[model samples]
Target: MNKSNIAILVLIGILFSSCTMKKETMPPNILFIAVDDLRTELGCYGNTVIKSPNIDQLAHDGVLFSNHFVNVPTCGASRHSLLTGMRPISKDYLRNDITELTLTNKQEQDAPETFIHHLKRNGYHTVGIGKISHSADGYIYGYNEAPSTKQELPNSWDELDFDYGKWKSGWNAFFGYANGENRQSLKRQVKPYEKGVVNDTGYVDGLTTKLAISKLNQLKKSSKPFFLGIGFFRPHLPFNAPKKYWDLYDRDSIPISPNPMIPEGVNLKSLHESGELNGYKLGEEKASLNHPVSEQYARTLRHAYYACVSYIDNQIGHILKELNKLGLDKNTIVVVWGDHGWHLGDQQMWGKHTIFENALKSPLIIKVPNKYKSKSVNSIIETVDIYPGLMELCNIKLPDSLDGKSFVSILEQKNMQTDNVAYSYYRDGISLRTNRYRLTKYYRKEEPTIELYDHNSDPFESKNISNDNKEIVEKLIPILEKGNKEIFY
Candidate 1:
């Protein structure tokens, strides 16, 4: 062949390689959905009672983490750990006001160093709606005060927003009842649950879903890849939902907890007296281990919770449907995660304040662009691990200081490994979850200093067999101690 023919072939080869590189380098858009106080009680997670078709459908198309645990069980601290990709350093870090304090006292760095901040720096348009942080709209405000100008995560989002609707501010929207009365204005004398006859838009989460859907349309036109975080507040408290959702279940048919009593041989300090539930003084009889709640009320509470779950599922379904309609689903990575789990009268506790299995374990589902086969990973993984996982998924550079390691490989492998372990810290208690056991250690010098439960034998964690299993306790103590160093007791 002549030199001219060889030159023509090389030019064609160069153009083809350039196109391939450009396509490979294009970052995928991220749709991060955060649900509040959601437990692993959905139909997908083997709970045959709850009707969560939308979330179950998402799980059918993606990966469902059967053993996903959070760093902290409460809302604020759990979200703080999730956003910062760090463990709790002090007792103050465990409070609901961590967002208000941290953003107020931001470090000398030019920009906030949260994961979303890093994403913004990397040419992604980060938009947050509703309660991504402790605040409802990612802004700071008092209990009954108007929304302030202060942003909770200053440099992390391009646009931090919320639709308070009838309730004036994000805080108010969070505690808003069907009649626009909040827990504060009513002086905490509200009922524990409500069955509103209004539509989905009657509550705050419905408004949030509307705003998020609108933002999705706008984000579709952006030049750069986008990271949209939509946080829903239903299934958190005052379990209010449309009567349509309430009608989905029979109140009498809801199953009560098999083990309603406090764990045997467990210290009372290890459990709380359902303080959050007791705050709603109207029609609520305080529940305790000694004086257990009535079985009828327990069933009613469970019914309300399931209704809220289905209500949120409908909202999620709407947002996901819009994503596909806009042709964004092909290039977007969808993640539906619960900040932490909740206790629905498990161990006679109605709130999430302990290091128990029900409080720490939540639902986590992820769907990449091309991988759509249904898969469930039963390995131990922490909420902190989300940062590195998303970074790896989007081909972004993982920061060296992040406490979590990427689970992208685990997704590809589609199986659990023997070495998988998750660590969680709440107050002075430090717990570690392994493949078959959950071992918790409180920083106290007492007889019940340790609490261990074998998940293989007792999945519900009804009994604490710490004292009986001396050999297992000896083996897991050092593992739990490894994560305890970060928490200053």
Candidate 2:
């Protein structure tokens, strides 16, 4: 290596060594919580209608990242990127089965298997509950099939578990309804939303919370520092929550999506027909890309989503309460992340799998227990950056093959000195999200293939201004291509 490169490496080594020395006495435990398909519309993110008081309180107490995007909008791929500290280089990285197809049933090797495995290798006992990886309970199984004996991340967790409750299996609990039935078992003959008149333990997320709380009690008594991962499935499809959470908001109080129409000047490739949301065969409305859903039906769906969000928020409140009650809150590094964002009728789309802002930007909050105060980061950061950032937080040596950079310095400084950008890939499109602009390039043909939306002027992404801003498009294409490690299929 050149002299300057060698010197930089030496400096980084010394810095990491110092952090290691600091954590010798009492290494912080991590309470890594991942929520499935949550958007950035919480009260903390400036949404006035949603009742996410607990999440808002956490944002008040921790650092809130306003511009957090995932590498891909699909669940498994996004979580894989977060675990491996890598970005999408090929079509395999874009699939929702990336984790199960690659990591499940694989043997542990010399290098750490994932960020969880990294913690396990460094003397930390890692425990995972619910869907930390792609599988609902970290087990490999089809949505319509019986639960299998396979574990998703065999090397990552010392005690990987999920309480299936009455649903019987991981996939059932994942696609489960308020009653014992699930969409898979019912053959998709169910409605898209539910407001069951039951208690907190009515839904699967309630049971997941109960399991997480029980695990926290056991972990507090353990001798070793623990890395507890709690994953909650909520605000996803078949939005099911207790009636109490649904009662938290009036139907009219919930607002409709501001940008429900397709942005002008964009081709048909940029739009989706909400197929995932329509998979619940008995839904009242089938979403269309050409015209938005009826106004009242849109509000009802948003209400269901709001109720689910509040339900998960309440579950998270219970977990954090137990953490503080056990006195582990002071020493635990808490991270609450949403795997990816949902459209919620934005841009006439219902689910993820698009490179739109709503699909890619999710909620991210980190509390390092006095390491950093409550702050907001507006600069863009992708999900791949999270794995290395966690390693740095725990004083572990980051793997050399990581495509992400630790945000520890950004946390310490509360500012972005680097060129902070987030890149996302989906459906033959590569999108770059910066603080001010979103530039997207699609591989489809026979249309105005480039799409650009200036966030500074139009945060809702109402129109594609690429033709109007040729100078900005030329300036950003090279930067976007540099981050694409494309191993074309």
Q: Please give each candidate's TM-score.
A: 0.94, 0.94
Query: What are the per-residue Cα lDDT tens digits for candidate 2 across 1-489?
Result: 999999999999999998777655677899998999998979999999999999898888988988899999999999999999889878888998998778885787887779889888888989999888898988887887778878889888899878898999888988888779999889899999999999988888888898899999998888788999998989888899999999999899788998988888998778788999889899998998867789999999999999999999999999999999999998899999999999988888899989989999999999888766778877678898899888888888887788888888788785574568898998888899988899998877747778999998889898999998999999999998886776432
Q: In candidate 2, which residue pairs get closer than 3 Å at backbone N, Cα or C atoms, i.e. clash?
A: none
lDDT of 1 by residue, 207-326 (tens): 988999999999888878999999999899989898999999988778999778788888888888898888888855778767888998889889989999999999999999999999
- Candidate 2 residue-wise lDDT at 432: 92
